[model samples]
Target: MNSSDSLKLVVKQQNLEDISHYIYAIVYPIVFLLGIVGNLLSSLLFSVTKLNRTSCGVYFLLLAVFDTIALIGGLHHCLNIGYRVAIPNATYCRARVFLVYVSMDMTSWMIVAISVDRYLKVKYPITARIYATQKLAMIVSSIIMIIFIVKNVHLATVFIGDFSSNAADNCDANPLYPKYVAFFHNVWPWIDLTTYALFPFLIVTICNAFIIHDQYKRRVKLRKRNLDRSLITLLLVSSISLILCNLPITILAGVYTHISTSTNTND
Candidate 1:
C-alpha cells in the first residue's frame, strides 16, 4: 500500500480498537461488578440479619431487589456490546430496554419511599407507627412496582436494529426513531435524578436535621450528652450513605446526556 493508504488503514484500526476497549475493558466490567456486589450485599445483610428486620429494613430489602434487577439489565447490555452479540432480534431489545427503565424507576421510587418513611418516623412518631408498618411498606413497594411497570411497558414495543451493515455484529435501535432515544437517554434521566437524587436528598437532609435538632434539645434539657452522641452518629451515617450513592448517579446521568447529545450533533 502507498503511504496515504497505510495512514488511512491505521486510522481505521485505531478507531476499531477504541470501540473495543470501551465496550470490554471500561464500561462492562465496572457496571457489572458494582451492581452485583452492592445489591447482593444489601440483600444478604437484610435477609440474614435479625437486626435488619425493622420497618426501614423492609425498604432496604425492596431497594436491593430493584437494584439487582437494574444491574442485571445493565450487565446484559454491557455483555452484548462487549461480545459483539447480534442481540438476536427486536424482541430481546425491547424486553431489555423495558427491564432497564422499569428497574431504574422502581429503585428511585423505593428510595423515595424510604425517605418518606424516615421523615415520618422522625417528624411524627405517632403517624409513623400507623403508616410505616412492615406490611404498609410492602404494600407501598408493590404499588410502586406496578406503577413503574405500567408506565414503562411502552418500551417493550419499541424495536431496535443494527444500522451498520458493515458491522453485522453491532446492535442498537435505529436512530430514525429518535423519540425512543430521546426518552431513554434524555427525559428519563431527569425524572430519575429528580425522584432518586434531588427529592430524596432533600427529604433525608430535612428529616435528619430535625432529628439532630431534637436530639440536641433533649440532650440539653436532660444533660445527657453521652446518649445523644450515639444516636447522632447513626443518623449521620445513614444520611451520608444515601446522599453519597445518589449524588454521583444523578450527576453522571446529566454528564452522560450532555456527552451523548454532543456526539449525536457531531454525527
Candidate 2:
C-alpha cells in the first residue's frame, strides 16, 4: 500500500485495540459491585452480631473490610480505565492509586495475621492468649496500613499516560522522576508480590502444617477419631479457600507486569 494508506491502516488498528480495551473495562464494575455488597454483608455479620465475636470472626470481619476497600479502590479504577474517563489530573489519580495499594496491603497483612493467630492458638495456646487479642491484632493491622501508605506514596505521583512509542495504555509512574519511575512501576509490583503474596503463602503454609501436626498428636493421644476428623476437615477447607482466593490475584499481577514490559519492548 502507499504511505498514506499504510498510516491509515495503523491508525485503524489502534482504534480497534482501544475499542477492545473499552469493552473489557465493563466487566470490572460488575465485579466491583458484587464484591462491595458481599464484603459489606460479611463485615456487618461479623462485626454487629454478638455471637460472632471470636478471634476468627474478628479476622474475617477485617478481611471483609479490606475486601470492600479493594472493591471500591482497585476494581473501580479498572472501571475508570475501561470507560476512559478524563483522569488527566494528578491529584485524583494519586488518590485512587493510594487507596488501591493500601487496600491490597491491608488484605495481605490481615491474612498473615489470621495465619499467625491460628498458629498460636493451635500450637501455643498459652502465648496466643497474650498475643492474639483483638486489640493487638488491630494495632498490628494499623501499623501495616501506615507502612504501606508511606511506601506507596510514590505510586500516587505516577500518572497513567504515554511513556514510550509502543504503549497503548497510560501506565502509572511519576513523570518528573524518570530515574525511579520505571523501577517503581515495573519492579515494585514484584516486591509487592513477594511481601503481599509469597510471604503470606509461606506463613499460611507453616501455620497449617503445624496445626495438622498438633491435631494428629491430639487424635493419637485421645483417640477421638470422629471429633478430630471433623475439626481437621474444617481447618483444611478454610485454609484452601484462603489460598485459592489469594493466589490468582498475585499470579495475575506478576503476569501483567511481564506482559506490559514485553509490550513496551516490542513497541
Among all candidates shown, the one with the greatest TM-score: 2
Model 2 lDDT tens row, 47-104:
8897255666777787888778777765433643354333344565567667777787
Give the true-structure RMSD of model 2. 5.7
Q: Model 1 misses residue 186 by how many Å?
A: 5.0
Superposed model 2: Cα runs more than 4 Å off: 1-26, 51-54, 158-171, 224-244, 254-267
lDDT score, candidate 1: 0.67
Clash count, predicted structure 2: 2
Stretches off by above 4 angstroms in model 1 are 1-38, 48-53, 80-88, 159-186, 224-244, 247-267
TM-score per model over all chains: 0.67, 0.74
Candidate 2, after superposition: displacement of residue 72 in Å?
A: 1.1
Q: What lDDT does the true structure give each of the candidates?
A: 0.67, 0.67
Candidate 1 displacement at residue 116 in angstroms: 3.0
